[model samples]
Target chain A: MTREILAVALLAGFGLATGSVAAGPAEDLKVYQAYFEQHFPDFTPEDYTRGMYNFSQDKRAQYEAIMEFPPYEMAVEEGQELFATPFANGNSYSNCFENAGIGIAQTYPRFDAERGKVMTLGMAINDCRVQNGEEPLDVVKGPLVYIEAYMSEAARGKAIDITVPDDPRALAAYEEGKRIYFTRRGPRAFACYHCHWEAAGARIRGNELSPARGQAANFPAYRSKWGEMGSIQRRFKGCMEEFGAKPLKPGGEDMANLEYFHRRLSNGIPLNAPNNRF
Target chain B: MPYPMISKNVALAAVFTVMHVVTLPLMAQEGKGASAAATGNGPEAAVEQGKAKAIELCQGCHQFKGADQAGTVGPPLLAMKARFPDPAKLRALIYDAQKASKPYTMMPPFGRNGLVSEQDIEHIIAFLYTL
Candidate 1:
């Protein structure tokens, strides 16, 4: 009995030693999220995930009326068709991912331990295409967005459960993403943190800026501006373009890392993808 | 046949050359107002236009006075003379603020991306001098 007790203590110590190695987030993720909540004291945490729609009562009413028939339904139907169809090599996307790609959107933008990088769901889809001897779709729009839309619809209401493991590389990635979020880029020199974090509820060009927390949960949302389905990557590119900065490629390391940092903030929020928005 | 192909290539080159020559002077003429911004003493530009323009462009990120002073993103336009001793430096900073400050500043470059012209920046400086 004493030997067993000694062994258990050693095992517990080992576990703690390993856990401490990663050092966790440099800044508390909870504190970062709280910054947003503190800024908009009127808004409950739930209202922010839907973006600018819930910013004002008048706007919410207008958006709610619009939501009766979300504009991106056609894209969802088109995506369902595309997802069901087989690839050129007689293999389909089902062969690449688990559970035939249903409800898998919430688990993505995950850090692949072997590759030592974040793997966005969009990148995984493209990977399946390339592996099956087909040309990969562009990350921004068209087929990729369509497929993502369908996947997001499938994963609707699933809690965002992205795992940022306590690994040095993962911690480093989160740090890098945090830097990108806060650091200003190029001649149109404003960081995303300045607009989104500092000016969380401020209006810019008919749009109320949302806080960074929980915004990542709903991707492939139906944007009225686009008149179709759009993904997080497409929105990110648009933000950079507005500031006159050269936007990063969709599914690239920086974007995936950015998603990683974001998913941490909305760690358990239910996905409301295929969502309607202005 | 060879002569005809040569003439086609030459004509294409000539067209491009003409475009370059025509565009050069036009660009210089456009930059003429920008150079005058160095002095901030151009007779053609007016101060009132600048005051209105300052409220529209800068009010989003900076506080001016009682009127459009809601912005807290940037530093308040206070003690304008000491903060920027040289009016030209102020113009350069407004033109391309990233160059004037450290590696990371929240101030957006109104001048560099041509979002705001130098002449417009000149008017903004005039308005700021009042503060």
Candidate 2:
């Protein structure tokens, strides 16, 4: 056989093999974890849950000092009260969630077969309120965030365990989420992949960029810049705005799907929400 | 991967060649009266102005050769004159990298976004040539 023809045959065979096989969630998880482990040998999967603190010792020290008296304590306390308080119909948030809504934050952003959509913890909170004849709280901030903060506190130390079902709908949502993450958009023209994936551990101006791994672990976090608690969706909105794009609606389909994919990246990282940040 | 990438690079180079030809006359015109930094000023003054502009706009994400305290988010600016022999291609990259090169680049569209002017890009390009 001629060298050129043989090379073409080999390439065609390789293409066929790769085209038939798609990477499943397990493969994605393995590769995702491996990438971070290779890039940052010093960090345990658990350390990634702390966000940017994993990149800098100085930042970690400041974070440790801040953690000694976390400002989110009040918000967590209020959330605990809100979670337990009976609705107008005398049924509480407990009735709607498994395990009475305690320590279950890690399993959230789950595919809801009944609802035919991805349901975030914030969405579930609103769903519970709507079901119990109470008005839904603000989806991105305020009381909804407090509840999510409390749930994250309750689920502390539990590893993230997001499951994508065998259903085609669930897989479609996940693929869409993955697309949203890697596709560049807006005037600044950056995908979530640009800053968090490609430039992770690098400095942007004075601020160090956080890794995509374990980013989902600390939500409903207290950012010093915001001077208040914010949910992952709120952070998403802020990031899109920073990209000079119109912010996606919080708890919307796109945001939930993005959260689903993002949370999957932190699959093995333990939940550590209500964390403080600079 | 190598096969397709080689072909893609060749195609990109052809596109850049055309762009360089089309833009050379306009660039020459701008050089005559754009600004003191871009016009008849000596290469030293233009390079100095370009260096200042690079530090102000690009130092946050990219490091220049022989520079300290510059960022590493983007690749270091080294051997620029060799890397981009066609200066118009470099100008196109700084103006709108996505349009000039890869579509998914993290580099912002400094000129298109009004973050930097055409004259500013000229100064920055002059400084980059030195590196």
Candidate 3:
């Protein structure tokens, strides 16, 4: 065969082979952990859970002062109150999760072979509400962020430990999440990695970008820009629109899978949710 | 394997060629964007516009300040006056930088992919000239 045709044949064969060979979760975790460890050499794996403040010393100082009078503390108190209050059926979020749903944020966004999809903590809380005949809460703000903030606060210092089941569906969901994280789209054609990975420490106007590490640990975070509490899902939509791209639905499979993949990337980092930021 | 990310490396040769070829013919009569920077006295308005775009887009990679300091992605644009003094070459370079630089330069083809308009690129070049 000619050189050109031979090259095409080889590429096609390689593509087919790549499609068939799915890597295991442990392998994925190993590579992802080493990536952040190498990039942010200054911070320990747990330090990433500290969020943007984990970078510069000045930023850290500012973050500490802000934390001294954290604005998100009230939300946690309110969430605890809401968590215990019985619904019309006298059922609470406690019925849906183990250990009364306290300190379990690390084990969430898990692959459920029975559901054939991933299940995030927010989704589980909403499921409990629905089962109790209560209207489901929105994942963006209000009670959703409040409750997640409370759960994350309770689970603070719990190491993130998501497990990608051996099932093909679980692996496929992870691959899809990885694809979304890397795919460039919209008017700007900027992917998540474009800013977070390739240009992690660079400044955009007044805003300094954060690296993708330790992000999952401090979610349901407070941003002074918004003057209120928000979830990682909220930030994803904001980032997408900022790049002049349309965002996916808030609690859809895409969002959950993306969360799962990101959390896994920061695996073993302590969960320190409800953190305040700029 | 996870350091640089596999997704980034998935950029195939075919995709790059398709984008560069499709966007090259867009070259047309000059817009006011590039000239504003060269003239020096053109209203600071156009320069500001260009600066805004650069701050939003390119600053993530290329530092426009002294010695092209900061940033780890692309080379510094601090010396654009001598490096890419010609407007046409600058425009072409920004449009499909990877193609102009090499087959695998990590710079995104902002022009070819419509990430930034031609007028905007001229404005970015105008801002680059000031640096």
Candidate 4:
């Protein structure tokens, strides 16, 4: 075959294999270039361009002013203080866990075979509060959630070390979390992979798409676009909206499970909370 | 002494008159050319050349109507007039699209495009001002 025809046949074969059948490589590149040209009219191909991923100077100042202790660090402090401050029965939260070390907070949303259900760290904390004969702190409300943020912050230096307790219960929870991540429920019929995984490193409008693996490390980040301090759950809500999906309530089991999966995927990444993002 | 003084004064006045008469129309024509180009019309046809050039190079992304959705990849051109209200700055942006390096990636340098002439750039600037 002629060189031009051979090139066309090869492109067709590649497209057929990939399932992106509508456009060939040349046309796809054109569309990609056009998309970037239109969206990022000022973008230059330079090494320094990576710096744009960080928060702007003004946003950094705002985050420093507001998120003082980082969310989980403050949560841990509150949890500790609440542990000292007893309920009407004079029982403390320290009696619930085996070691009572805050570092154990990272391994959570594990399956409880005995209970035949998923158990998140937030639930574990609230369960501890209730087991001690005290009214449990609302997982979504009050200083407890912030204290959770604080605890997560305290465990920041520690790597995500979730051990799937070689049990069916834990496996079931992990499977459920994976199901939630891939299931298409939104009006747009887009799964998380549609934007995060399949389109990873692709440009949408003017922004670079972030890899989902590192996503868990930047939770409780200060999103400048929202103009408020928020957690990973809050960012998830925004993503739901973008996908035309109903948002799950904060501190819900599903969100926790989703977080469990996301954190596990980010196994070794260090936490960079109260992070600033566009 | 009075006659000599009067002669010198006349000579000075005549020199000033000649200079003014010679240069005024030339300056006026240049001004008119620039104004006509800005208004999308000019005696030299630069404005017409610019409009054609814009259609060839920019219509792909800017889309003829300047609507944002028309070109989903780029911000709407209609909004640009509002965003860059100043004509001079807009002109500079078009002229140095490669240099501004804003968050958005700019159009390829015109020199690379091989279609844009200096006159074409001037004309495009003129056409843009009308928008």
Candidate 5:
């Protein structure tokens, strides 16, 4: 009897220690659990078994069928043709990048020290156009969407690997981007952090807000409200309007810099574009 | 000669005394005005009056409780205290409410309809601060 009691006590002690470890930091855990309970109550450890995984085959097919009717899919198909088509000078877009690599879509919003700017993948594609002596495609226009979809399709299996360089200028840009996100602006006086970072997972106008982190991985999404396809910058513009602030033009420097900051938040997340979102 | 001189001095003193006495209420009114300007209310009674007016008028739509109403006709005022902590900005929002576009078309203007006086709006803001 004495031996059994001792064993029971030891087991209880072990359980308590394990429970405390699982609890984590109280404040972080509280908000994290609150959001999880509200948005994804059914989510489990099994859901995260893989580092980055697509939906099951059936689910993927369902989403694909939904995308078929949208005009954006047509844009992506057009982009694919354009990628292989030679420019008037006989230089193909595939040859413009180093090593003729097709999977360079994910390493964008990179710091370009020569220009002292954070260059998005869309911007890089247009830059390639200029080098080829063709009129650069407008980044905000529908043509860019096709080009992006085409390039991203080429990078289907490639992992996202954007590096924030250790250069002083690059570091300064990151810090500036972070500041811009946190600083309150407009008549409503709301900062990006107030909604996405701080109040994430909370209900806003009957919608569950996703955390700003791990956001860049999914883009070129089919927004149910928009009833069409949109890229990250388009969503950023919508958020600005919601805050009662004037939105920056799509493909502008500020948008690129902001994307650079947002991408850093999702450092290791895999790129999944043209995904469905509500 | 002595009687006339005494009467003349008495008349002048009487005139001056009457003038000072008549101006005493005006001086008191000025003091009250200064205090009212400093404290934003002429007296404590006015603030009480304003609170009563807010409870009657603004409480219908701006539910002070944090619970989700069946129909969220207007934006919840529970987190508003935190959202608009600044008193001046809060006052501006109430007084110049048209600056914000409503999600629905039916929210009527309280100030424009003369349902709330400027003083009542100030008091309602004060009451919101307490919440």
Candidate 6:
């Protein structure tokens, strides 16, 4: 009896020591959403799609006013034209996506079983270009941002519905992404969880840190600072630079996996992308 | 044309170049900390400087008891003299917080990053003690 009790105690201690709490995608979604909800009791999950604007009524009002005359309207038009243009091999971007890539942005950072890797929408766009005998666009910015902005606009109001398959590789990818979220790095020695999780809605200097929950729902947003539309990967690179860390490649495996886990956390939140932000 | 030999030679050159790039910064960083000792400031002057530095940098996240601007991001820094009786321990926490506490601390390693020097931290410690 004594020996059994000691063994159980040791196992429990080891589990806690290793920080090896088992968490699946569903559990992660629940925990992250619950955390944000607990922090911002007044906010609905949909409110997070606006990022920092959710924290301040003044900012939200400004954001809403800007939305009435969205700066990205012309970019979205350009993106639609780009999407419809034929490649040298006479294949349109429509040939490469389901439902002609109309309203499918919410299903991105998906586990691609055939490729044994995660596939972000930008990667899919590049794959389409390659398949259609056209040179791939820059994954981080420029025309790709406009194209993704167009797709994001189509996906607005759709609930984010990312899926992590039961395959071991898919699970592994998700696990890697979760690890990246929690791992501390760079000169600051901070993880994504520190600001987004522990200090969600807390003011850092003059800026309010956004909760990580529905941050993925809006992307390829038109940042007032950039004065242009940019993708989520571009934002990731910028944040990493602030952390004083060498950023992972845009559209690379690590970033794709990170987005997979991030978007999964935002499961069921309505997407509101191609939005303006200050 | 010996294509494989050329490729192998190029690979070797690339490897050497990467090694050179990786080591140069580290070599440069080794010589940094020697000049970071206390500047011979009076106790009152040091405290004033420390208060200014804390407001400029630390106040953004940490709320000091007497500070006008409050931030709720990190824990409120109060009762510092009681919490850190030893100034060295406090200095270590400011230098590399991840090393002192858990790995996921949001506190920037001010000393490690050269954001604050030893003299600056010493002054900051003086201000903390006042709290």
Q: Highest TM-score: which candidate?
A: 6
- For all predicted structures, in order, the TM-scores are 0.72, 0.80, 0.78, 0.50, 0.57, 0.81
- List of chain B TM-scores, one per candidate: 0.61, 0.67, 0.62, 0.50, 0.49, 0.67
Candidate 5, residue A232: Cα displacement in angstroms equals 1.5
* lDDT tens digits, residue span A243-276, model 2: 5787778878999999999999999799988788
**Mind giving the per-residue lDDT tens digits that candidate 4 earns over B49-102?**
556566656654465453232323234455445676654455445544434433
Ordered by lDDT, highest first, the candidates read: 2, 6, 3, 1, 5, 4
Over the true interface, candidate 2 deviates by an RMSD, in Å, of: 7.8
lDDT of 4 by residue, A61-98 (tens): 65456556433344455645765576677765566655
Interface RMSD of 6: 7.1
lDDT for each residue of candidate 6 in A42-73, tens digit (9 for 90 to 100) = 87767778778877899889989998999999
Evaluate chain B of model 5: give its TM-score: 0.49
Give me the displacement of residue A57 in model 5, in angstroms. 20
Strongest candidate by DockQ? 2
Between candidates 1 and 3, the one scoring higher on TM-score is 3
> What does the lDDT read for residue A153 in candidate 5?
63
True contacts kept of each: 0.29, 0.55, 0.12, 0.00, 0.00, 0.65
Candidate 1 per-residue C-alpha lDDT over A1-278 given as tens digits, one digit per residue, 9 for 90 to 100: 23223222223243443345543463456555556656667765466666666566788899888878887677788888888789988898889888888998888777888878887888888888899898988877788888888888888888877777878787678767755665566566677766776566666535567777768876777777887667788888888888778887777889888767766677667877777777
By lDDT, the best candidate is 2
lDDT of 5 at B124: 64
Would you list the rank order by DockQ, best first? 2, 6, 3, 1, 5, 4
The alpha-carbon lDDT assigned to residue A69 of candidate 5 equals 74
lDDT of 1 by residue, B1-131 (tens): 11111222233224334534555454456553334443233332335546666766777667667334445556778889778766767766776665666333456767776666545665676667767
The best-first sequence of candidates by TM-score reads 6, 2, 3, 1, 5, 4
Q: DockQ for model 6? A: 0.28
Estimate, for each residue in A1-278, the C-alpha lDDT of model 5 and write its tens digit.
23223222223233443345442223322433354345445544322112122224454465557656754566568877877788899997777676453777777779998888888877887888888988887664466667777666666545566666768787667656655655555554456655554445444444444566556666665567787666778888898897467887788877887888776655445566645565
Model 2 stretches with alpha carbons more than 4 Å out: A1-20, B1-56, B65-69, B78-86, B96-104, B109-119
Off by over 4 Å in 4: A1-80, A202-208, A221-231, A249-252, A274-278, B1-131
lDDT of 4 at A96: 65
Per-residue lDDT of model 3, residues A187-272, tens digit only: 55566765666456665444567778777778888889899999888888998887678997799999999988877777788887
Q: Score the docking of each candidate (DockQ).
A: 0.13, 0.33, 0.14, 0.02, 0.02, 0.28
